[model samples]
Target: MVHVGRPRERVGITRRSLFGGVAGVGATALLAACGTSTAPSAPSAGSRSADAGGGPSRVVALSTGHLDHCLALGIVPVGLAVAVSEATDSRGIPDYIKQAFGDRYDLDSIQVVGQRMSPDLEKVAGLKPDLILSNKRADKGLTEKLTGIARTVQTNGGSEQFKADLKIVAEAFGKAADGERLLADYEGRARAWGARRGTPGTFSLVRGKGDQYLYFGTRALASIVGTDAGLTRPAAQQFDEAASRTLSLEQVGLLDADWVFYSFPGNSGDFTEAPLWKKLPAVAEGRAFRVDVDPWFLNASTVAADRVLADMQRFMST
Candidate 1:
């Protein structure tokens, strides 16, 4: 058996420690836009899987989210594509994936195909994959190129449609039963966690973006999880038209709520120097907590969703 190693430990930033003597604050990156696309073409007719006989054994995932979906469905891609903007140090794989699957799979053996948006086709082709997966809808040319290499499948990109996206992947690999079971299990966990809380107050979602702040809407991943747990959102964050809205320093009051779940990229630095940031009720009362960026803002896999739920349970109970 190929030995798997434990994931490297990551420290969650707290407002008090990371922001000096001032009030605490948490942050997150700008929201990624999900483009529109028609449903992906299904696998060959009469075939239950990506291949003719069984299912795809050799797969290539073109994004961290898709990679997580494959792993969640018991499919490990031989190749993976990551974006240059990925915050994890473990090549392009997110830290949450490492923590969740590190003990079960030899992640290091998986080859890096190329950047998430534009993979190195040569490397992908070399993998000899039976199937490829992606969620990007804006680039038809890239999809065409990948399809030429293997049986490529894609989802309508967005965090809000994460469950639907997972269904698409499961269908592509002939694991619809497993996919539905996974969703049911996840929803059960989220609902159970919420039931235990018994009215956890309005939770604010914030992230640091450059010099400003991002207030997440109902459509964001964390927000979705929060909804699953019966958590309330501040009035300003109730809109679902967009994933997030940019907030200048002067508008920091919009982030105030009963609690705050926030994250920022490692390079984005701390955003605690502003007076308005210090004035937020959650910050002053020490309700704001830093979270991992990969699961909070980037990947939308089931592992990421589980991590978000786990983080909520950990921080809210404190």
Candidate 2:
């Protein structure tokens, strides 16, 4: 169901069917904006190109994941769409990103075009950006609309394809070598960290939101990082076809592991307080810790991967 720019190629598989019947009950909509999208506005000459040599500079990030990729490649977007968590932030940038960029960039100045699901096309057009970085979340209709405003590039998958996504984003920005090097560096660091840890026991990743508990699978950012670090996943979380498996509080024991990392969009009480949750070995042993949803669940680039690795080290030690 995800399509991108022409010559009319299908860039991503449909995530709709991947989550079982969640799409029918509006849960998929909630997850759809895991990243954000841009809006439309009038295109101007200023938006055409930021350089005399036809290189893109005034880029508009249609998704936060793409935004992370841009930042990783040393590019600060002229504008970006934000996820719900990001929209709530006064600065419109995630805290991890703020700390990562530090004073090297002015985070507040980047215009927030709109939410991921509903980008303000007019605002995006108003920015007159030369490039638009998005994921497959930008449908054919949105892609056409975006192409009219600026050159648009979308990767094949969302967080599920972070490696390929980062490479695609880097290529679009004309930094293929840098992108490859970044990936290699991340792989090296992850392996080195794994080696230092010797044989850490299985790690479990869960997310609490509303009434449901999400068990991350192979496609999730944290899961991917765990694999890179040579960590093991509980059998329930070993699959790759879907991003995650939705579990009811009654099934909390399925998330049990030697170490458990859980995060929520806000407070963690929703699914964490259930009776089954307390019975989990990790929870009983005080090995479960709450984590931030931004880099762990939302952002899926090298920058976020690094944060996930650091978080793993910190949480495992505690």
Candidate 3:
């Protein structure tokens, strides 16, 4: 069961469950540094205004996952969707947000929205947001409709896009200085980690259930590690687009990496129990690792990225 510090909020009857039921397993011990026990802080109340710098008036975040970046730069939204579920265990949303706003804000306060699939347009329109912040994966039709009601800004959901997105959001809210500082700090940490590990090692990034898909050779975080962290991808799979391409379990052996840093459905049980996953060379040799999905890949927030780098350092050092 997912453990929450507080009670759940009521919203639409649908009541979507976050990553509940997923066993923390081998990765649990590694995530202690990344998980937040409290909500992150919101931007100062008077700091953000339509006339502050003549920016967009009403702001709505369709991508609730990236909320951490907005909050870090002091950009609060009229609406947000929560991703916490019973499976999350000890990791709550970032403590900065929860401590700042208390219970006044939660995922339900923001109009419920979805990505890739159709979101509740009527409900979103009712919220009457002035601007919408969404990821590239959001449904194109839904974004178009939302634009009719408010201005829309799209962010690429690549690995490095998280840092870039934070800067863009901060600039949109007149917090460019804050965004830059945060990025520099994160980049510095990443560089330090990279310098310590000499001689690149073979690596692969994977996700999903039953059929595992490998991620490599793209501009995302995986590529960042391979290029910046001194890691190398398998010679055969070293294509220009491997980072973005998804592969099947049968192809897992083709990766032939010295280490595998991948994501799994947080709801699944222990990795050792899964027969198909057990067959992986990385997993068998304890070279495979599971990362928190929200912060590592799905969510692109400033705080989340920092947590990701810390986690990566721990994994690499071990």
Write candidate 1's Cα lDDT for 136-244 as tens digits: 6638898888889999888877788888999999889887866777777667767876776777689888877655668889988888888888898999999998988
The candidates, ranked best first by lDDT, are 1, 2, 3
TM-score, candidate 3, is 0.66
Q: Backbone collision count in every prediction?
A: 7, 11, 25
Query: Could you tell me which 10 consecutive residues in candidate 3 have the lowest summed lDDT?
Result: 12-21
Deviation from native of the Cα of residue 243 in model 2, angstroms = 1.1
lDDT tens per residue, model 2, 43-136: 1112223323466877888776786666656566778788776214854577767655534445565788887766899988887777888767
Which stretches in model 2 have alpha-carbon errors above 4 Å?
1-54, 86-91, 265-270
Candidate 3 or 1, higher lDDT: 1
> lDDT per residue, candidate 3, 115-141, as tens digits?
324556665566666677776776777
Worst 10 residues of 2 by lDDT: 1-10
Q: Mark the regions of model 3 whose C-alpha exceeds 4 Å error after superposition.
A: 1-57, 81-108, 114-117, 135-141, 209-215, 246-248, 266-284
lDDT of 1 at 245: 91
Alpha-carbon lDDT, every model? 0.69, 0.68, 0.53
